[model samples]
Target: MNRLKLTLIRGLPGSGKSTLAKTLNAVHLEADMYFINKQGEYQFDPKELKKAHLWCQNQCKYYLSEGQNVVIANTFVKHWEMQAYRKLAKLFNAQFSIKVCTGNFQNSHNVDLLLINKMKKNWQP
Candidate 1:
């Protein structure tokens, strides 16, 4: 039987979380993907942030249950933000890992510098 793996990639915006996830050969997922429109345009709605995260978590769970390696890249500024993914990994008996990306690159989502700074200020790491 193939072993399942769940990888959580955490970092600030532009920190290379997504870049690293792509190289891991897993089903790469991110909450921001929930904001993408059918046309492939990102239409982020601040009011739906919670829903977006839930969707991402649900997607991860689905893929893990199907015995696939899943990688989630998100700005998990606080440690608690990773709890749900950790629980999912436990439920699936998957080997889980948390990777923090510290590279400074251009943010694809265009998150404001001020907000990114605030997130950094409150980061648990």
Candidate 2:
């Protein structure tokens, strides 16, 4: 049996959450990836982000059940969001850790800005 670990990578618009997610070799489930409209504006429809979040949570559960690790690369800007992930981690009997990266820290290649601009340009809802 493999032990599942739920790693939460939280940050603002220009944080390096995606980089960290990739570094961990885990799944990268971010809401912005799902909300690319035709105009390339990365705006989620009303309540669509929540639905995407739920989908990620379900995926996480399935992976954990199969002894895989998951890294949630998203801006969990609210306490409720954190709580929800924690609850899911508990339900899966997996170890959970929260990793917060404030965009203020110095990093390589300014991934946050890149992601922001990419979303602005290519986001197709």
Query: What TM-score goes with each of the models?
Result: 0.98, 0.69
Q: Residue 110 lDDT in model 1?
A: 95
The worst-scoring run of ten residues by lDDT in candidate 1 lies at 1-10
lDDT for 14 in candidate 2 is 55
- Local distance difference test values of all predictions, in order: 0.95, 0.71
Q: In model 1, where do residues sit more than 4 Å from their true spots?
A: none
Candidate 2 minimal-lDDT segment of 10 residues? 116-125
Tens digit of per-residue lDDT, candidate 2, span 6-104: 899887655677777889966666656666668876665656867877777787777777777888877676656778779878988888998876564
Give one digit per residue, the lDDT tens place, for model 1 in 1-125. 87899999999999999899999989999999999999999999999999999999999999998889999999999989999999999999999999999999999999999999999999998
Q: What is the C-alpha local distance difference test score of candidate 2?
A: 0.71
